[model samples]
Structure formats: structure tokens, C-alpha cells
Target: MAPPELHPAVLQSVALTVRPTSGAPLALQTKVLDLEPQPDGSTTLVVAPPPGLDPREHHFDATLAWTYPLGRMECTVRTRPGRRAYGDVWLVCANAPATRLQERAYFRARLTVPVLLTWTEATEETEETEETEEQPEPVELHGVVVDLSEGGLLATVPSRPPALGTRVEATVRVDGENLTQPATVVRHVAFASGGHGVAVAFAEPRRHGDRLRAVVFAVERRRRSRT
Candidate 1:
């Protein structure tokens, strides 16, 4: 039986991992270029080939894996066996169902590191008429990172963590280097060990790519050493 057509929005945002049935994997990442819906509920997709990918090998049956709003999806795309276009190549594929999306794509390394968290309360400010009063300092909480990831992290705090969705600044020491960034509390759970588990997502994702990559490399190195 034929599968349902994937949503156009999902097709636009998802990145595809294209693997031909008979060939080596492409080097560069491939993203969706365009999607053309058909009256019969089928859709034609234009996928961008990675740089260094040979244009002559465009024709063949290949498996495409991508993540959409719903979850991860896989489908088979077949290109005509002939000369294909130079820029974006067109392929016909069957729509498939998506599974549950994972919370983290990158490997989460288990480690312990001290961290300082700070945030200000909205109701803490006071009105001053005669003399200008200085704003109260942000409340600081000490915590320890339980696991780390490029996107976010899970930590443990001695006290109850800040309410979910609360934005806070974290100064964490990674490999003797102090890295500070703003993050939002996504999950808070009290553990049996008397500490609270807090999950935070980085607010400014663009600025910490280098630090995250370094941490990932360090974690992988450490894992290799143990193995």
C-alpha cells in the first residue's frame, strides 16, 4: 500500500541523509530544495546534492532519512537513470510515517562539572521617587552538570531548580575553561538522592558552536580512552 504524503512544511525543513543502493555515501549534507504535490496525493521532491557528489550517479534507488516536526522519517527515492540536472536533482519518493523525535541528536556525554546559575525575579524591583535605587543582584545557585550536549544539558542542583521556562545564565567550567551562556529551564525533577535534576536548553544557539564542538571532541576522546 502507498503511504500518505508528508506535509510540505516538514519537507522544507528536514535534512535528508541520502544513501544510494549501490554506491558510496555522499560527502556533503543534503537538504530539501523543493516539493511538488501531485493530484494523486504523491509529491515530487527536488533534493540538493552535496558538493563533490558526482552528477552521473544521480540515477538510482536511494533511501532518504530526515527529521520533521512529527519525528524521523525514511523513504525511498528513485531518480531516472540518465543525465540529471546540475544544481538540484529531482527524485520521486513515497511518503512514509514518522516515529517519535529524539530529545537529543548528538551523543550526550556523562560527566560532572561545577556550574553557577543566576536569574532575576520580576517582582524584586522596587519603585524609587527621590533617589535612584540600584537593581538587586541576580540570585545565584550552585549546581553540577550531570551530562552535556551541544544543544543543551542536564544538571543537578542542591536546591530546587528554578521553575520551568525560567531563563537563567549559567557559567560552567568545561576543561578548565569557564563558558557562560544564557539558557532556559525546560525540565525540573526532584531526585531520590536529595538533589534536583534540571534540564536546560541554550537560548543563543549560534554563539556557542565552537565551545560545544570542543566539548564533544573532549568527551569522545575520554570515551575512547575508557574503551
Candidate 2:
């Protein structure tokens, strides 16, 4: 079956692997410029080809992988001779359909990092007047992140986990940088190891998403290199 049409708004980043007929594969990170299929059943993928790509090597087997809201997906396509669409952009035609890969949208890395989680509990207002807004008592919890991802994180806390759907502010140290973001608690589980595991989904900020994905991808690349 043909894959669903990808709206430009949902396209964030793509990982491309190009394999020449007689050379080793080369991996690149790129973004999708367009993906409209022609009447002849061939799909043309307009992408921003990364640096170090040989303009001469156009006919090759390439695999494009990307993540969406539902899950991750990938497809292999045979490239025809590609042409430069504009400055630093290229249009490559694909003669095949995309294969949807059933996996989580974001790549999760098993990382143990210190994180500070804070939330507020609503308290009764001392003043009965409607103009007075009820003050919430702020609560803080210190936890160690068991795993990290672009979407959310799994953290182990010593005390009782926050209730589901609770909004929280988290400050986590990643790659020597402190990232503060708001998240919603999605799950809570009691661990046999004597702590509660809380799963929270991040309210992804555009700028912070890129930085967090960079850290996750860097760690993944390092792990791949060592294997």
C-alpha cells in the first residue's frame, strides 16, 4: 500500500543513507523539501542534500528515514539522475513506495541524568473575593532520569510519583547544558528497586527540540561507532 501523504508541517528532519553500487554507504542528515508523486507512479523527493555529497554520483540506492507523530518510517528508493533545484538543493526521483516502520517516533537513549521536577498544588484562597486568584503551593522532587528522549523522559524518584496529567516543570542537565521545559506526567509505576518511575511527555519547544535531538543522535552515533 502507498504511504500516507506527508504534510510539510510535520516534516522535521530525515536521515538518509546512500549506497553506491561499488562503494560503502554514506549517511547524511537532511530535510524534506517536497514529496509529490508524479502521474507515472514515481515519487520525487526534493531534499536539501548535505555537504560532501558528490553531484556526479546521482544514480544510487538511497534509504530515507523519518519520524512522524505516530511512529518512525523508512523507504528505499532507486534514484535517477538528480538535478539541482536551487542553491544547495536537489530533486531526486524515487521509483518505489515508502515502507512504514513500526517504531516510536522519537529515539530514546538510556541515560542516567539528574533532573529537578517541580509542580504546584492548588490551595484554598484565604480571601473569599472572586478577584483573588487561588495560590498554589509549589512542590519539588529530585529524580534521576532513567532514559531520555525528544518527546519525554522516564525518571525514577524516591517519593511518590506525581498524579497522571499533572503539569510539571523540569530542569535536566544534558551535555553540560541545563534545559528547562514544561512536561505533563503521562504515567507512574512503582519499581521493584524501591522507587517510582514517572513518565512525562515534554511540551516540545522548537529550539529545545533541536538541541535535545542533537544530544540523542550524538549518543546514538557514538554507540554505533563503538559496535
Candidate 3:
């Protein structure tokens, strides 16, 4: 699930490894249900086989290559039309899987490559006063990254949730292999994991800012999970 603020594109992909173990009269079809983006920049995708496809009649399957970063994605498929289904998913690189990896066959080692790119673009800044946190830590981890379309990103964590008037530094990671920078923290919200979501605005994004931004995007992408 995603908050209303995060709107992401719907990535489409196919699910291979399905054999006529199914007798489905008609061929199987696949589509991406939706993609959910979180405030942290991570994303989750939902998919399933098309309706009107019979389950017992045919063992149907297909593989899908969705939008960039999420290349070579696969899942076990089943469709009950108006009911629910369970799928086994495996994330692989576009060049991976010389042959479609089978589902449930109890295979050897498998690799799941992430489509998330490590975008760098960050700035450097510091926060002296302890404004926010469930329990303030001595040091804070923060950074900034450019969004997919020149969109900017800000990330920060404070010792505790600060009052609305508090001001702090923001950090941006530089792009092109270099990383790290400085910025300002604007607001803080207490997160469930004893972390605060510190809203920030960078003072200067040029000069290695892009590198940090790219790294943060990579970090954010790694945090995404399919609950």
C-alpha cells in the first residue's frame, strides 16, 4: 500500500514457467495490477493472470519484462477469475535466466537482481541541535537524491521528532562515483522504527550533489519489500 502523495507508474511484465499442467481452454494472459510508491522512494508491484482464464483446464504461464530497472521479473501464476490467487515471484536481471526459471520445481541456486538504480546527487550540511527522535542519537544519517525526472529528494533522521519550528542541516550525495554533501532539514515526523522523517531542502545541489542523490535512490529502492 502507498500514501496518496506517492504516485508511480504501472510496470508491466510477464510470468513464465507455466506449462499445460493447466488445461486452460484459452491462452493465459498477464498484466501488472499496479505499482505503489512509498514516501521513502521504494516501490511495490502487484500482478496476476487475466480473468476468464480457467485454472484446472490448462497449466498456463508467461514471462513479463516490465519497465526499466525491473527487467526480467517472473512469478508463479494462477487465476480464479473472481477469486484470489497465489504466485511465486523471482526477480532476475534482463540477461539472466538463459531459460525461463521454472516455478516450484525445487531448483538449485537462483539470483534476484533489483531494477533499482543507485542515483547519486546529494549535498552536505550539519545539524547541531537535537530536535527530533524517540531517543536522540549522537549522529544522524541523511542524504538527498534526484528523482526520476529531475525531481529532487530529501532524506534525514533526527534524534527525535522536532517541533514545527526546528531547522537542521540536509546532506546530498554527489553523483559520478563521488558521494556525500550538506543541506538543511525542514521538518521531522516520528517514524515507527524510532526514526524520524526529516523533510529537508538543499542549499546547493551542484558540485557532487547528483552523486549523493543517486546513492540515496539506490538505498530507497533496496528498502522496498513485497509484504
Specify the poorest-scoring 10-residue window by lDDT in model 2: 1-10
Which residue pairs overlap in candidate 1's backbone?
A: none
Predicted candidate 1 versus true structure: per-residue lDDT over 1-227, tens digit per residue: 22224332323444444555657754344655656566765666666555666644554545566543212445655543222445546454654433323444554555678888899754524433234667766888898886666667777787877888889998788878888889988766433233467778778765675787678678769979999
List lDDT for all candidates, in order: 0.61, 0.68, 0.33
Candidate 3, residues 1-227, lDDT tens digits: the string is 22212111244444433444536434434555554344654333354544544423323243333222111223333322222345532222122222323232111121111111122222232234343623333344433221211112323233443343333333332332332334344434322233334434334556444454455456546656422
Estimate the TM-score for candidate 1: 0.49
Error of 3 at 164 (Å): 4.5
Best by TM-score: 2
lDDT leaderboard ranking: 2, 1, 3
How good is model 3 by TM-score?
Answer: 0.25
In TM-score terms, candidate 2 sits at 0.50
Could you tell me how far off, in angstroms, the CA of residue 38 lies in candidate 1 after the best superposition?
58
Q: What is the TM-score of each candidate against the true structure?
A: 0.49, 0.50, 0.25
